[model samples]
Target: MPIAFTVTYAVFAFILGSVIGSFLNVVILRTPEKMSIVTEPSHCFSCGHRLAWYDMFPIFSYIFLRGRCRYCGEKFSPRYMVVELITAVIYCLSYLVFAVFQPADWWKIAFSAVMFPVLIVLSMIDIDRFEIPYWCSAVMAVLGIAAIFVFPSEIVWYERLIAMGVILVLFAVLVLIGGMGGGDMQLMIGASLLLGYRVFAGLLIGILFGAIYGSIKKLRDSKAEKQLTEQIRDIAEQWYKNQLDRGVGYVADERSDVIVGSISDGAPDIEWEFLDEKVWVGLPDKSELSRMLRQNITDEREGGFKIFISGADVKKVKYSRRMVFGPFLAVGIAVSWFVGAQIVDWYTNLF
Candidate 1:
């Protein structure tokens, strides 16, 4: 409880977070690729130059390097540095909230400290790839299961079970209805076990943020959607026409070696690259395709062009394939863990 001890722990938390964050950069970059996280040394993405230890020292390394590759001089993204800073903050805050600032529970602090990196992994992986890695959720479930024995809350065991069951049901419905991915549901289920009734607060917060972002994104994407309407229609028309005229099939998935598919089979086959089958129609018209294909946005708002000429007019369509829920759900989970008890209490007090 001494001020000196609290400061020391906070410092330790920040330093540890920075080191973990450095490793997390590798995890984020490699996991989606199925690359071994431990085998590969850190290297310049643009050039095959291996980085030294000093070059990998978290935030300071980025600052020293001026955000450019020291070997290739290619300007790298600041996101790596941002990740480290965010991780540092998360650890520092976790210690302060669970240990120093609030109840000095080392157990809670340890749980949260572990949670900080797991969350960073989840959030970054989701952002980089629209899909959430099952392993992250698995780790989370393991942590939650451990919590049942290690740091059980005051909530009745039955209540915790009911809350987790309720959340699982709700998430199952959402997944079946097609708004969310199974991974998000799995993460929620784990979170529910750890958070109990408080998981509702997390869901609410997640939904709120997802909606707000979806709304903003919808507005921004409207133009791209408008442009894509013609492009999709044109591609579909050409593709169908080619099939009709030639009586042959050019599979959508394989247009070229470099380009995986005309539009890369809806599931991200490659990272940071898009191969639209429309290119086969002719050289792809960039005007029709938004640069942000990694978003895994199959269609935009205002209904994408109908791929098939059917009962519905080609011009008329419906918005399908909304935003990714993983990142938003992560946001909610973090917020809930931090303040869900307070939120639940405040709501209950109003009754």
Candidate 2:
């Protein structure tokens, strides 16, 4: 390719990627909030001032205004710039990778460019809101299905079906075991359509990564709890010894009054009455095994020293299928690209 043509293509890709990224921002913000993404013009979240055309130039606008809304002066998230930049990079990289390594297929390059933004949106929304809207995955699935015709030699129909089946079964098992949600299944189906059989491998990788992350967090919390318990014990011991030295009838068996206050406020008695009332109102019993597991896994522990093991009827928050769908899709794309490129190269060499 001529240098001029390459530069022009890069610039075009950047602009296109920025525009798509802007739309993705809207999708990410509105979808989870259950709002119309198209109906509402871009506006400041704090003051709700509608953004003007000049104020909405993707990465540039965010940088020009120092990452704040002009009307309300509310700080815009740096995520906006990051998303736009990432999209642009993906677009350029897609073109470069296709042009350099594979056949100069514009369609393949375009498809790769489009998938990145969609995946980016899904990943961000999943991270922030812990949910993924069905529409996003549906759109990706539709595109993936259509791409089968557009690039028939790249991936096969039966391969896609097998990938979808495998992921669907895996997701169903996770749901049964309370490890994943329905949205994850839908997301997986969509991703499998795009990536075909390779999606299964990507999903395995993502699940492994997620599990490792969750385990690390649990270990950190456990260590913090142990440290806090030690601190509380030391404080209690000191207070008890001081009281004993003063001879104020402070009972050592009950520990110090201050220590009692610390532990009492920190570890309030479980409000079983409130939970029982909720159960009477058609809510699941607080004593359910699932409820207990959710409390153990999800509840935030406060106060370093006092262990608050209160069992209340806490709301259960499940993993969003829609959110996981994005990362899975990204993984599929990467796997597909590598697999497809290698296969294509092998065939070309043999011919």
Candidate 3:
């Protein structure tokens, strides 16, 4: 009987999780794009066709559709299936930790279920854009504070204060050193509120995960750089040989414009024309070059005048699913274990 009940619960939780995860997919994509997640019906971005009920069935729908839009025939990213599957796993695990373990009050179980989705959304947003919007973090912080009061085995206010204070200070130092972003600082504060002293464990884990991630990325980047350099050298050598065969005198002059051109049937094919003249070289051409010139001029115009327009190197950023999902899973399991133990003790005392 117990075995049957556990199986039923797991299946139910999986379905529920997949549904919630489907909603989360909408939030993750729409929120960063500043679009209405609720108001906009699930539709094909390519064809603008509204998704039918069958087409909206979370993970199964994607599989049945063969990962293509029904109306537009546009291929959907496999990430849709990946997100739904991940959410389903999180949901099932939360249920296993809460329901099977018998936590102190059903409230904590409900709260864990709700918090997991929020964490998933925020983590994805941070990974995608590297920014946690003020409103989302603020709301999470407020809710975490409120959870402390609502739960049966309540954490003291001082403990909450201590956790928040310690994380805020640590995050401040990180931000000062340019090690973390302001959004990360806010996220840490919210996490501290939720996890209390356990936040230290989370912080240590996050740092270790971040370090491993950075190392792997650095190796990949080094390989890519080496390949690009070799490719560029080969192209340059071929260009020089072609110039010699054509009897063209190539002079590397600092004052003159450097026009990198190709010859197709002995006709000059200008690939790029780099002008080394003054930055402000009169008005721009009123064609395709006008758009390019306008963008450059705008950047130059704002360079010294804008307070935020500092010269900073930009790099491509990527996020690992394990890093984002792992902490939340750890915290949820920890909280569930603590609450479940208290519940077991209380039940034992009743006998």
Top-scoring candidate (lDDT):
1
Score residue 59 of candidate 2 by CA lDDT. 93
Which ten residues in a row are the worst by lDDT in model 3?
A: 301-310
Measured with C-alpha atoms, the lDDT of residue 291 in candidate 1 is 36
TM-score of predicted model 1?
A: 0.79
RMSD of 2: 11.0
Q: CA lDDT of each candidate?
A: 0.70, 0.61, 0.59
- lDDT per residue, candidate 1, 196-310, as tens digits? 8888998998888988988888898777666654555554455445453563533233232122122323422222154444434334333323333324345333221223232
lDDT value for candidate 2? 0.61
Model 2 agreement with the true structure over 1-351: per-residue lDDT tens digits: 778987887788778888888877887777777899777777778998888988989899999999989998889889988888888777777876776455688877867766676678777876675555677678778877876788677668887778788878878888776545666677777777777766755676567666676566556666655554554444334433443455533323322111111112123122333332321223322233223333333332322122221122111211111113345445545655546445445556997
RMSD from true fold, candidate 3? 12.1
Q: Estimate TM-scores for all models.
A: 0.79, 0.64, 0.65
**Per-prediction backbone clash count:** 4, 4, 0
Candidate closer to the true structure by TM-score (higher is better), 1 or 3: 1
Q: Choose the strongest candidate by TM-score.
A: 1
Per-residue lDDT of candidate 3, residues 224-334 (tens digit): 444433433343344434443553533232222233222222122233334332421231122332332233332111000100101121112121111232334334434
lDDT of 2 at 67: 95
Lowest lDDT 10-residue stretch of candidate 2: 256-265
